[model samples]
Target: MAKTLDELLTVTAPVDLPSYDSRATTGFDGKKADAEKQLTQLGEELSNLQEKLFAGGRSGASPTRVLVVLQGMDTSGKGGIIRHVAGLVDPQGLAITSFKKPTPEELEHDFLWRVESRLPQPGEIGVFDRSHYEDVLIGRVRQLATPAEIERRYGAINDFEKAFTDSGGILVKCFLHITKDDQKERLAARLDDPTKHWKFNPGDLDERMLWDDYQRAYALALERCSTDHAPWHLVPSGRKWYRNWAVATLLLEQLRALDLSWPQADYDVEAEKTRLAGM
Candidate 1:
């Protein structure tokens, strides 16, 4: 069985990270290795199941849809997870969209408009790199909204998600949790490596300076938004390998539960076989 959101978050660490300003760097190398092995096995099983679903003509019949939202700070492996996990799904039935700072036209619409416009149709899996939660997370953290406004938006988001679930969409939201120390190390690595420099934004360091603020914002976001229908998974991401495994495992578990089936065939297989043989 897949780990429930509560169970996954309840597993105590050897050292509790500073709730507000974490600079801790305890490695989970052993756990990561184990997770990697488990992920490999799970990945194979998921691939096999997906192939059966597609080959059995199930893709067109049941038309189940999944929406996976990944949200975290800069360089939290959101892009990497998208590249790997979505690669496992059928390319023909998947859509991946990355949200950045709003464009001029997007600024004219409500926060959820851009996200709602990108929702996948039936039988498709849609991956959002950074999602509407940004409004709650960054918007609140940056004090872009009043407390009253934030509270109002919280209920709005809940209702929005409920509507999706009611309409046959499976929603999975993951918050990639990484320590400040790990983020610092990643930032440094990006600076040293020429190829990765493009990913290093000075603004990310600016945000790092307000790391404590971000954590508080995240804690509240998780508390407010995590629901019975659309819960949040806080994946420990100090280690990237473990992060990938955790996400892949969660996705595989959810997809496996979806019991996809093929449409009924109109013609008899025996008749078709005989007709083909004669030709």
Candidate 2:
């Protein structure tokens, strides 16, 4: 049987990160090098499979839609992963959305209203940079909602995701796990590099002060919302390369499981040749 999201989350460390020095090698550590290599090979195979699945398919048999929701704190490598791993996917069938602070209209509506409007159509993949989970994660962490309100959203989110999955969409939620120390280092690097200075926002520094609160929020979100259909994976994100590989591997694995093939059709070569000759 396949592993449940809850089981995966339980097995994952709440706050552990791979050592930065260890990332200099191919694997996370020497112990997982072979496994990592295998995953990379699998990712490449999956990429090829995805390409084949999208080719020569028309109205009758549409490919399965994949929805990947990526959520994390400041300085998390969300943009990097999207640029690298998802960049490998066929651009024609993929959609990427990055959610920032709510606009006036969005703030007036329910949190999920905007998200629902952006769902992937058949044969397409939608990637959410920050998703509806924010209603529970950041909403709770920032005390934007009351305890009862936060609790209510937990069930609502689960049901919403269940509906998406039941309707033939595959949902994968990844929480990019990065350490505070690493985040500081990355943020500093961004400031030091002139080209990256534009990426820096002073607001991120404020969020860093509430690191523990965010962690607690994430733990609860993981504990409550991880379901069999849409599981959340905590990607150790200090190493941007490993993070990209892991995300690409998981996506490839999920997409490979989908039945994405063209329906059989009859063709008349002789009739076509005769018609062409007559013409």
Best-fitting candidate, scored by TM-score: 1
Kindly list the per-residue Cα lDDT of model 2 for residues 247-269, writing each as its tens digit.
77667767767745654555687
TM-score of each: 0.83, 0.83
The CA lDDT of each predicted structure is 0.74, 0.74
Lowest summed lDDT across 10 adjacent residues in model 2 is found at 18-27
* Runs of candidate 2 exceeding 4 Å displacement: 1-44, 52-60, 266-279
Given candidate 1, what's the lDDT at residue 30? 58
Where is model 1 more than 4 Å wrong at Cα?
1-7, 10-34, 51-60, 266-279
